[model samples]
Target chain A: MTGIFFDAVTLSFGKRKIFDNVTLKFDCRKIFGVTGANGSGKSTLLKLAGKILHPDSGTVNFPDNAQIAALSPEMKIYDALTAVENLKFFARLRGKILSDEKIFELGRRTGLDMKTFGNERTENFSTGMRQRLKFAILLAVDADIWLLDEPTANLDDTGRENFFAEIQAAKSEKIILLATNDVAEAQICDEIIRLPM
Target chain B: MKLFGSRCDCVLAIVRKDFLLNLRRRATFAAMMMFALTTVASLSLSTGGAILDEKFLAAILWVVIFFAATAGLSGTFDDEAQAGTLSTLKLYGDAQAILFGKMFVSMLSLLALTIFILPIFCVLFDVNVEKIFLLLATILFGLIGLAAAGTLTAALTTSAKIKGGLFAILLFPVTLPIFLPAIRLTEISFTSAQVDSSLLVVIGAFDTILILASSILYDYL
Candidate 1:
């Protein structure tokens, strides 16, 4: 009841069946790795859990008041807004007003120095910087469920260390789903759900 | 009461973010302003000192407003989609709040355009407005209707391959109800100085229906 449940979930894209009669329950407070090859429904599974996509049949259930946040490569930050502004705007959307100090703390947790680059518009940011900002946004929302697809794709070595540390720190009370193909990343998960190609 | 408060916060946040983006980009507002100014100036020059009839003038005014609204407002959702932020909004923001916030921004843009163009239109065309209050009311209602219709059309077409073209095509047909009544009301204001209560009611009703429909349809999209 407190975590995500998929009951007889069958989802298809046109004629190709992505999830065929799949039933899985994610009810733990540890990080779960959804590992699969390219085009193997890794991201699709996370999206289904996030309710961004609906199953063609069956049901995916989570608590009614559970807050969910997703970070995918397809997601983007506002180009014209500064990094701090972006974090504040996203937090506000979820009815939370984030102070500058809180935003700075989130930034620091993601290996980003708010005092240095917080005021610059994100359009000028590099790929790694944008990825770090996305992580900061993920932290700012402070959701109960986190659906992170390819979470470390564009992060540098330092950024990855910071990300893993944060994940390890927050794994006690949150259900974190990490969809990745990297063996090292998958090793960090307590349970690995491998999707068949 | 708590739900209502949260909804208001979401709406306000969306409006604030959009306004800031528009201010920074300056593309949509600039395009709308340029389209309105160019059309009005061209019509004024082409008239060649001839005293245009009130009905024709009213028609011209509405035509300018209509096309300008189309040119600028159709990108409301297209911009978000193109920038890859539409999904983010869908994930975090409430459906009704997003619809209302975008509609409110469109309304503000149209109101600003009307203020900028009305005096120039009146002076260049040498048209004496008999009822200023009625004219403003008619314009206000017409713009609200336009904003509502445009916002819905933008949302409906955000996923289209040719979003801008589809937006214009769909908007014209969908907004006919608002345009016809609005044009008539403007003419009444200009010529007879008599208000058509029924026409105002029609436009208001259209606005309400469009806003409600958009709020419902947005979640599915």
Candidate 2:
């Protein structure tokens, strides 16, 4: 009933079945990679865990007191807000009032330029920069579980290296549920589950 | 428990973010103000420079508020969805808090619109409001009902393909009850008619029901 769990879960839409009687558990302090081809329900799996989707006949349970952060390309940053403002917004959502210096420091660690981050809205940032900025906020959250869907999509080499380094550091105390197709990314996970297409 | 505090923070965060976003764009505010002004002007000109009756003026005022509020507030969730921040807010905190926060923002926007339009309306129509305080109370209550029902309708139509059109269609029927009492109260305020306590009660009850329903329904949404 704690950490993250799927208990004989079934998910479907209309007559189409996505996951059939799937059971899995993701523990704390480990990286979990959900690898599958297109239409293989990797994202769906994470959605079930994140409580964004309900299973037809079973349950997905996460800790009651745990703080969760979900990151995806579809997860948007406010276009009118500066990067630091966005970070502060997310921090406030989690009930933490972070200082601007701390926010900028987190962005810097994620390879964002502090100058542009402080002045410019994220609407004008490059795709890599946006992804890095979002990831930086996720890191700053220090959540108990992070649901990341294709988190490295638009990251450049340096950004990817920084993310991998951050994940490596955080894996000792956080639970990371990652959904990606890249073998390199999958290789870093402590456990990997490849869903059937 | 700290739960209440956290939820309050979440609501304030949403309200602040939406106000700033709308302030920067000014699109909805401008649209509502323009629509209100245009409606008032057209109505003033249509009588061939003759004075219109208080009942007709009351009807026209409610119509303007309805259309302008619909235009301004229907995109509550749609804008968030387009900006890709709905998922973030949905994931981060309580959905009910988001609903209340959105309703609060809608109310604030409508209040601003009312403040900007009432003076222009009085001047253009050449009608001195006999009961200004009563009219203000009526408008305030009407706006609360509008915000509650409109915000709930916005949530319902968030996933619709024909968003704005569908939102308007769905909103009209749900808000009719509130509009009736509001228009009656406004008409009374414009003339020497006696005040009706029951109408005010009806509007207040409508607001309470709509807000409670929206709060409960948002979880399923």
Candidate 3:
């Protein structure tokens, strides 16, 4: 799909121009970090790339019928599901049955434990834990593009490390686009693009 | 190589996911079941005498279906909208398939609920429900139309703060055209056991139009 390319992509909501003729490209299978001020459009850029919202102008080159794995800020993990249950739900969406062995492997990769919390419903898991679980689903799905928005928003130091590790392992061949407010998060990125809020 | 669209596999996947959600989430299914049962019981008990009048009986049946439709839609989209799965869904399949898929399950549930409670309705009202085949057909056609119309309106206004209320309001006017014949055909067949070919034609025509329009407008919705 041209390795995640944007040609003069511009998005304007009302009088404010969220993005203006912003043209950029990233090679496929690279970890890219997108950083911006409070309203500079880091998240908007991700949504545009994810095809959730169209740019007001210009075309975004993307794989046709790409199987996407996204961790949006607005994502709400089923409070009633354990980390395993949540992963299985997304896995099935891609037409893959969730095997027990596969789910265990995902939990391990994302630093989630099923022994104590796997059997339990996710309703009790902390917000940071929910964040970790969502990223875990992204890893399990193994989609062509990974659009992560603030994946480490609520995570503690260890969770942050695990989040990056999961993204790195998952990006061996998949395109990874991360939008974050954390500068440390950008350090691991192959390319960093700063957007205005 | 069908990348997207309402193929059997895609629809089945959505239906399977929905049915699984219904089974896993006790509160949602329990709430729908209890509401269906209670509404049926109260109508049967409170209106037994009044329903002896054919017009009143027909009206009550429509009301029951209406409320049942509402109860079903409320829980059906809850998973996608409330679960924040809407964004993920956008990337997986054609929006039309997802729309029809959700509508199919809701309509299926409506059919099951209608059948489950119809016997009790027949006994409670003590009306000779004439033209049994036609009556069943009407429910099938009527609910499919309802599901299509409701599916479009629900997606259009799902972002609203009062989605259920907004959905009812948005649908009420759009579907007014169907009400007269739905009632007329039901009343005609039930009262006289005379099958009105014209009435079924009207309902069938309405069904086709509504389903087609809803399907076409879903991309916009």
Candidate 4:
């Protein structure tokens, strides 16, 4: 009951049904993997969990006060700002004002180099570096639920390993709904929901 | 040191972000200012040393403002859409904060134009106002209406296929009532004619109604 439940949820675009009479329960204190092919409503499922999109019919039930932090490749980064500035901006959006040391610590934990984290504008960052920055932001927030869509898409092996470590540490403390098609990523979850089943 | 500590603080944070972003981009603001200057210059050259009526010149000022605002203000939400930031902001802040933040930016942009371009307009057109205070008041009130209406319409049309065209089509008709009285009041200020207190009251009332309506309906956007 402390987790999210989607009861008889229906979503459609024009005549194409994305989710039809789908019932899903995403529990806290565990990582739930949603795996499918590219067009399998994986991101939509996460968006529904984050309350960014409403189901056409049926109910999405989460605790009224639950704080949901969502990370996706489509999520925005202020490219004009430095990595530290981007973290500060996102922290303020989450209503938390972090000290410089704490921010640097988070960057370090997420595998970001201290020098690049402090000095580089994200516009010049490589794809793997940007993914690390996004993970750093996700790690900084204290939320009840974390919804991640294709979080490892742009990362190299080292970055993926760092991500898995951070996410594994937080699995018991937060509800993590991961949308991915990677077999290795899905294997780490306690349960996997393969869409279009 | 921080601007997003409370709900009101969030509004200011959004405004500050938008102001800085626009300053960095500069294309939209520069395009609008250039258009305004070109319009004013063309009008001046065509008039050819003739003394245009004060009412006509005042009307010209509003016309330039109308076009410039329509040109630049429609893109307020376009940046949010492009950067995929709107969904994040919606999750983070209340609707009123987002709405007022955008409205504040629109108002500031228009007011900046009034401040920078109006003086040049007066000099170029060889017109001087007898009541500068009243003229300023009228311009401010009129811009409030434009900002309120412009923010709403921009939000509504952001996802439309023909974005700028749709924005103008939806915004211009709704803003004319404000423009008509604003032009009249400005003319009165320029000619030092009897101040029609009733007209000022009407413009103020329209502005209030626009802001209230936009605020109430913003959640839907």
Candidate 5:
């Protein structure tokens, strides 16, 4: 009741049935790795938990007051906004007022040189920089649930390390459903749920 | 305890973000202004020094505003969809906040376009607006109606394959209520200089209903 639960969930895209009568429950204070093949609905499962997608039948339920944050290839920050501005704007959306120092700290944790690029618009950022900006947003919102789909796709080695460390530090208090194919990433999860069972 | 966030703050944040993005890109505002100017200039030249009827001119004014709005404001949600920021907004933003925020931005853009074009239209056509205040009120209510309709259309068509075409198709019929009353009000402003309070009420009521309906329906979309 205090976590995410899927009850006999069935979802299909057109004629292809991706999920059929699947039930799973994820408790808090744990990092759950959702692993599967390319078409195995790893990301789809995370989307369901994040409430970005609804199952055609059955139900996906979570706490009423839970705040959800998602980082996926399909999620992007405003290209015209500066990194700091993006953080501030998103925080405001979640009713959180972030200070300049706190924002810079999030930037630092994500291995972004926010002091140098904070004022610069994100359209000029490189791919890895944009990914870091997304991570910064993920941290800024401070959500109860994090649905990360391929969270390390564009990060460099150091960026990946910082991401893991952040996830490890926050794992004790949040319900994080990480969808990834990386063996190393999956190994860190408290439990790994393989898709297409 | 407010778990998610304050709805009012979320709406304000969305409005601020959209305005900032528009300011930086200058796409929507610029497109609206360009279309308005081009249409007015074309009308001025095509008239060939002939005196146009006030009622016809009133129709032309609303037509120009309507099309320019269609061209510019139809992409309100498409911008988020294309940029892939829609999911994030859905994750953190309240549904009513998103709708109102977008509607506010659309109204502001239309207001700016009107302010920029009206002077030029009046000068080029050599038309003296006898009841300027009434004309302004009509434009204001008409714009609110247009913005409400346009924002809802954008949200509805954001997922369509042929978004532009569908948006125009749907927006035209949906906004006819606003346009009919707006055209009549404009004509009265120019000729009789009398308040057609009934038409004003119609446009105002339509705007309110559309906005309230959009707020309830946006969450589903």
Candidate 6:
């Protein structure tokens, strides 16, 4: 299934044109990377794809079952909630009730421990640990499209490797749109497209 | 979906989160409570000399609610705005959920603030409880309108912290038409004549319109 189809999409911030009539089609089940220098439309394009930004011209269509799961800083993965509770909260938003098996599977894939990171308020965790729990949240959602902004941001080398492993695991059957400033992140994706300013 | 399972359930959960967050943070809660308390107390002492009447006292009491609600409602989205969680919420599918949830929680707490101030208002103003129910009713109606308006304005002002404090500055003028009628209706409740049923009707109308406006502009905000 095809996920997002953007044709001749033009985006502008006030008088400045960020994306110029760009055409792209995203397959529903592949890992795609977006690479660009500073001031390029990398994040803007992802926002456009996620329906968070409207194109000045042209259209971006979603697949029949397209749903977006982005990393959020406020995921409640703390002393108040078990891993089941955390995943349950996010999954319930989309009417999907993830079982305990699925929660642990995603936790392990993202290198987050339900037994450790769970049952503790996310307030106590380090930034890197909280980010991992967010990754666990993204994986827990059975959405058709995944748009990740700065997925490897502020992570150590080990955290970066764990994130890559999680992406590899997630890439099997979902359209993955990875938006990052780091060009090295491009190597893991099947193909990379650089949006011109 | 069942009532507990629907997005409506999330509304109270979000309200609970805001209340809990306020409860846990002692300094902020203490300060806001003190602010609410002293305002009501001073008003009571000042008006305790005036005719010592319930009707006039009820009038003074609601003025306190207006300011308190404006102050407290602005804090609804403060955490998300400062932390850049607003962007994350925009990407999240349930903008409606987030909007209504925050409004529900913020407005509910503002109501709680009203609850806290009511007794003080009753005591200091020496208000007659029976006649002042209209004052109480108007406070609820007024907060809903204020919260809806403040929530939308807060969403627009999220990028700038300075404007958040000036919420009432924006809210009062736009909502000016509401105050006179609501206050007049409240004053009538003190009178023995036929009640102006339309005062609350107008507030209800205003509430519906504001809620609709907030929900519609939420995506763009």
How high is the lDDT of residue B113 in model 4?
Answer: 81
Stretches > 4 Å off in candidate 3: A156-158, B1-7, B24-51, B78-80, B91-94, B161-164
For all the predictions, what are the DockQ values? 0.85, 0.79, 0.37, 0.51, 0.88, 0.32
Candidate 5 clashing pairs? none
For all predicted structures, in order, the TM-scores are 0.97, 0.96, 0.87, 0.94, 0.97, 0.86
DockQ leader: 5
lDDT of 1 by residue, B126-177 (tens): 8888877778888988888889889988888877786547777898887889
Off by over 4 Å in 1: none
lDDT of 3 at B6: 27
lDDT of 5 by residue, A1-197 (tens): 27899999999989889999999999988999999889989988998887788999999999888889888888888899999999899889888899989988998999999889999999999989999999999999998898988889889999999999999999777899999899878888999998873
How far does residue A65 in candidate 5 sit from its true spot (Å)?
A: 0.5
Each prediction's Cα lDDT score? 0.88, 0.86, 0.74, 0.84, 0.88, 0.70
Residue pair clashes in candidate 6: A78-A120, A78-A121, A78-A122, A79-A119, A79-A120, A79-A121
| Rank ordering of all candidates by lDDT, starting from the highest | 5, 1, 2, 4, 3, 6
> Taking the tens digit of each residue's C-alpha lDDT, what string does model 1 give over A1-197?
36899999999999999999999999757799999889999999999999989999999999898888888999998999999889888889888888878877887799889999999999999999999998998899888999989888888889989988888888888888999998768878999998999
lDDT of 2 at B101: 89
Candidate 1, residue B47: lDDT: 85
True contacts kept of 1: 0.77
The segments of candidate 5 whose C-alpha lies over 4 angstroms from its true place after superposition are B1-5
Interface RMSD of each: 0.7, 1.1, 3.2, 1.9, 0.8, 4.5
